[model samples]
Target: MGRKKIELKKIECPKEKSSKYSKRKKGLLKKAEEMAVLCDSDIILLVFSPTSKPNLFYPHSRPLGRILERLSNMSEYEREERRSYTKKV
Candidate 1:
């Protein structure tokens, strides 16, 4: 059987929401791992629960610190590009 579409609104019942969250979170992490393995790509996933618990996923070859550092560097590069473009305009 196929899955049905789910609405984008918040689930009203806390118990139902929690159950859905747990199932979907596992599926999402599994998909991330599969993509990394099949595509030979680095994957890092960080999710916070409704109660603010952290769940982190790093593929076998990827390090969380390295991912954060690379993301920080990219943001800096993007900011510089934006500033230069603004100055030229």
Candidate 2:
């Protein structure tokens, strides 16, 4: 039998919501790290919690400031060009 699809809604209980958020955040951070290493590219992930606390993830082997500076220096067109090139097979 096929698996049942879970309804998408905000988790009501605070404890359950926190637990789910923690688990999912950990998994997302792991994937971000893997992608940075596998692609040999600079990647930054910023997530804010309900409390407005920020969490940042990037390739630890690379300088975080350098990555941010490079990203900040990129023009909007350059950023879009890079994304387009990457999307092309």
Could you say which candidate leads in lDDT? 2
lDDT of 1 by residue, 1-89 (tens): 99999779988888898898999999999999999989987778889987788998988687778877876777777979978999999
How does residue 22 of candidate 1 score in lDDT? 98
lDDT of 2 by residue, 1-89 (tens): 99999999998888898888899999999998998889998888999875678998888899999998998899999999988999995
lDDT of each model, Cα atoms only?
Answer: 0.86, 0.89
Which residue pairs clash in candidate 1?
none
lDDT of 2 at 10: 91
lDDT, candidate 2, at 67: 96
